[model samples]
Structure formats: structure tokens, C-alpha cells
Target: MKLIKTEDAVGHVLCHDMTQIIKGVTKDAIFRKGHVVTEADIPVLLSIGKDHLYVWEKEEGMIHENDGAEILCSICKGDHIERGNVKEGKIDLFAECDGLFKVNIELLNKINYLGEMMIATRNGNFPVKRGDKLAGTRIIPLIIEEEKMENAKAIVGDEKILEVKPFIHKKVGIVTTGNEVFYGRIEDQFTPVILNKLKEYSTELVEHVILNDDHEKITEAIVNLINKGADFVICTGGMSVDPDDKTPLAIKNTGAEIITYGAPVLPGAMFLLSYFNGDIPVVGLPGCVMYSKRTIFDLMLPRLMAGERITYEEISKLGHGGLCLSCDICTFPNCGFGKGM
Candidate 1:
């Protein structure tokens, strides 16, 4: 790119977008990139205090901001994503479908570390709806060394750095294990809570079994649901350490590999997670999930629906941002709960 005086820039191509800002009215592009400077445009350019303007003048071994931005976009664009129109040497990526957003942190960091460019994105492993902004990319300067962007592409390799994994539509089975609710001595509130959460994803509760605090009955209910082709199973209540809390033992008896019996998150610390037949997941939720606005269950449910595997290490890492403040009008996920995981 080359800098030319606005007075002598008639017929030169604009290399960048120039903004016109009016205190209370507008802040928008007045001159767009690639606009050939006309004789009449000189007055407007001068009015905007453009004594000199960067004009497109290609130099060997260097890339213009627009091209550099495109390179950055290519590095991160993945499945179920749409790229917006390039404006001011920046491009925004949006989700084409409701899914889980993922970012390759190592590659992202390496691209940013290349300097003279930036790619900002939302936290990965979270739910995003169609048309949600996934990321934005731009080059810092009007021109950048071509070699730098190529190096970033090499680091990104053949695969893109960002992806949106579609949430799987699955049939869910809910088992409420509590003596009071099983015998109709008390109303069942846990079922509704679990049902409401399940609605957020494309999952249907195919079967619900209410069993008294009996490990054998709970185990039987889980096995029945699995046999009936339930993709996910949840057993609420009786997950605590009390002698009567038998949900953990029931899940164990099903021969499911227990991913975790407990988590470090508040309001759901006594949570239980296990996989049945090495595929379907069975979750034992604590009572707090029925009343608390958000819990560990809320944090990991999206990952599960997206078919992402959960490990003990991943659950342990949630402790850093696991404490929920329980705001009066909770805006979880938007808030800082379960961050950096």
C-alpha cells in the first residue's frame, strides 16, 4: 500500500474504509475500501481531514489488510459456519445452526501471537443458536508481511480452528429415586426441573420411573430405559452420602463406568456421572438442581447433548468458575460460571 495526498488522490483506489462520526447521529463508513477516488470525492475526503490516504499499491512479499483478514478467516472457519461480508478489513463468522461452539485454543493463540492480526471469539464448548456471532477477524495494519499470514495458516494446518457441533436429538429417560415421591407421600418436583432443562436441547423424555429409595429398582429402571433405546438417562435424588441415598449404588450396579461420583461445583457437589454400556450416559443429580437456578448440571448438559465426552479431569477443571452467585435474575452461561474449561 502507498500513502498519497488526498488532493492528488483522484483516481487512486482507497485501501481502507474511512468512518464519519457525528456526535449524536451516526458513525459509519463514508468511504469504503476499493472505492476509486473521484474528483468530487476529494472535497468530502478533505472535509474528513484526510490530508493523506492509504491507496492500494501492491508490494511484493506483502499482503493488504483485506487479503490478510481473509487468510485469518480461512484459518478459523469450520462446519456449520457462515462468513459475513468483509468490511473495513474485518470479517465476522456466524453460526449456521444451533450447536456447540468449539475453538482450538492452541492454534488460536498461535495465530494471534503472529502479530499484526487478531481473531476474537467466544468461549468454546458452549451452546450457540443459528445466526449467533462466532468470531471476528482482522489485520491490525493496512498491510502485513505475506510470510506471517502463511505461517499462521501452516500452524492451523489442514483443519480449521473453530467448529460448531450439532446437538444430537436423543430420547431421554428420567428416574426419580426418593421414598416420599415414590409412594406418593410428597409431590414430585424434580421431574419437572429435569424436563424443563431437557426441553432446551432436542431431547424427549421417553420414559420416567419413580422408585422408592431402592438401589435395585433404580438399577432396573436405568436398564429398562437403555433397552428401550434411551440415549440418555438421569436419576435424581438419593445421590448424597446418607445411608438412604442409594442412587450412586444403583448406577454402579448397572455395570456403567462411573465418570465421576462427585464434582467440585456448588449446589451440585454430590453429582454422579456414569456411562452405560460404554456409550449412553446416566447422570445422578443432587437435589439442589431442582431449586438452584444454575448448577454443575447446567454447565455440562450442553456438552453431553453435543455428544462431547466428559472426563474426570474436565469436571475437576470446572471448580475454578463453579461458584454461582445465584443472582435474582440469573443469566447463566452469559455469566462467569464454569469458565475457562
Candidate 2:
């Protein structure tokens, strides 16, 4: 990495295309930040009595946090933001009326960047008062390879440097295994329950299969699903110690590595998780999950849809909040007992 002073440049900034080669070194072979650059290494520039060398370091981005308290002020619909109303990102506003209001992140950014701004309300344009939370911004850290710093600088232009993490979408497959359901001895109510829970996320139920609790049959079914492109596969029923319970054996027979065969959660403590090629995930759920208000299935389904691979340690942590009170109100959406988002 090289840093030429502004005075040393004949005209504009002495920027180089750091995208390709840095000091005749390729990206794969370049030294990272915190690497020591000795003076003896600079044979050309050191010959001119230049003792100092430029080094690359990681840069961090700015983030602002907002308090939850906010107040609406009374003002006309066209009024602008009151000057000096916001100090240190806190604001005090007048109440136009009593109602639920939401301050989104976009409006907050505009207010912060452009200063005083106009807001739209139900009655009319009103001057925004203090103690109003405009928006919320999450802090993000950025890391740039030393060789790519120059390339970044040249293309930065008027854009702000922000680091965003890529979102990973998890694909899940469901396999319902039970002789009673397959032969119509009982209704196939389990699959519907699982599907209804999975519907809360962006997950696609890529494959669905029903197999008798035969080890070989279940094993073959699981292998076919994985081969058919299933990142996460769920097998319902046959998780207990009953002789007819062959789901665990079937999952093991597929040769997929098992992470945990039993979880510490209630109503679904017998849950199991396995993986193959460190990519595909497989789970075995117990019968209690079918009718339980909150089970291991409910707890883990969101994480799976959110692209989180469950670990045994994380599953173990659920024991504290695993018990469901099964209240009469049945406010599952607002309850934290295993249903908290």
C-alpha cells in the first residue's frame, strides 16, 4: 500500500487502481492489515530518504441509536420541523391528537441529513416538536482488503460506505412418517400443523413425503429428499423409544451427521437435528409437537426460516423458556413462552 501526500501530486489526488496489483503483488498474495512493513523493504522510495510507509487499516461506519419515547406536537399539516427542537438525536413534539403513530427509519434519515423537515399528519402539515424518534439505524462494521482500498477510494464518489450482511434464505422440506396416518388408521393432521407453522416465514416446503415407520423406507425417503435438494428436512413422529419409532434410526441410516438427538425443550424435548455435508439439515420431531401450543418445532422453525442452523447449545438454552402455560386466552402471538419472535 502507498500513500502519496497531496503536495507531492502535481494536480489531483495521487490515487492508483488498487483493484489489480499492489506493489506488484496480487490480491491473493498481498499482506493484510496489521502486517509489519519494514523500511528495508522499500528500496526505491527509501533511497530518497523517505522513511515513512503507508499501511492499510480497517474502517468503521457510524451508527445512531434512538430512545423509544416520542411525542406528537400540534401544528398545521404544512409546517416544517422546529429548529433546535432536536438535540443529540432527541426531540420534543406537540400532540396533534391521541393515536398510534409510527416513525419509520427513512424519515429519520431525512431529518438527520437535511435538518428541519416537514411531516405529514392526518389533520394537516404540522411542525415536528422535540422528543420524536425519527428513525433507527443499526451500526455496521466494514473491512476492506488493503489492496482494494485504492479501488474503493476511486469509486466511492459521493456515496457513503456502508457494510451490509447478505441475507441467507433457508429452504426446508417436510417428511411425515407414521403407519397410522399413511394407512388411514388416523387422520393426517400432523402435516397440516407443521405446514401451518412454517407458513409464518419465507420458507418453501420444497418436498413433502409420507413413509411408514420402517427404518429402510424412512432412510431411503430421507436420502431421496436430500438428493433432491433440501437444505432443511423435518421428520415428524417416531422420535420416542417405542419399537415402532424408527425415525431416529432412519435418519441415522441416511449417513447424515447428527448434531443432537434430544433437545432440552419441553413437549418437544425428544427433537433431533442432523446435518450432511455441513449444509443440509435434518430434524426429527416427537408426537407431542402435533397438538402442543409451543414446542421445539415452533421455537426452531423461525430460526430455520431465518437461515439459522440450530446448534445443540442453542437448543439446550431453550429449557429456560420452554414450558408453555397453555393459557385460556391463548394469546400465542403476544406471549413469550416459546412463541416469542
Flag regions of model 2 displaced more than 4 Å: 1-171, 339-341
For residues 1-341, write the lDDT of model 2, one tens digit per residue.
35654233222211221122445655442322222334333453344343443433323431121111121122111122222243222334333322122233243344234322223322111112233332222111122233332332243333322111122355667889889988889987888888887665446767899878788988888888777877888899889999989999999988888889887677787888888777677889888888886677766665554445667776666676667777877765346665211
Number of the top-ranking candidate, with TM-score as the measure: 1
Estimated TM-score for each candidate: 0.89, 0.52
User: Which digits, one per residue and each the tens of the lDDT, describe model 1 over residues 1-341?
Assistant: 68989998987779878888889998898988866689999998888789999997867998777788889999899999999987666999999999999998888998888888999999898899999999999888877899998899889899899999999998999999899998899999998998999889898778999999989988999999988989899999998899999999999999999999989899789999999878799999999999998998988899899987799998988888889989898887898888757
Best by lDDT: 1
Model 1 scores worst on lDDT over the 10 consecutive residues at 58-67
lDDT for position 128 in model 1 = 97
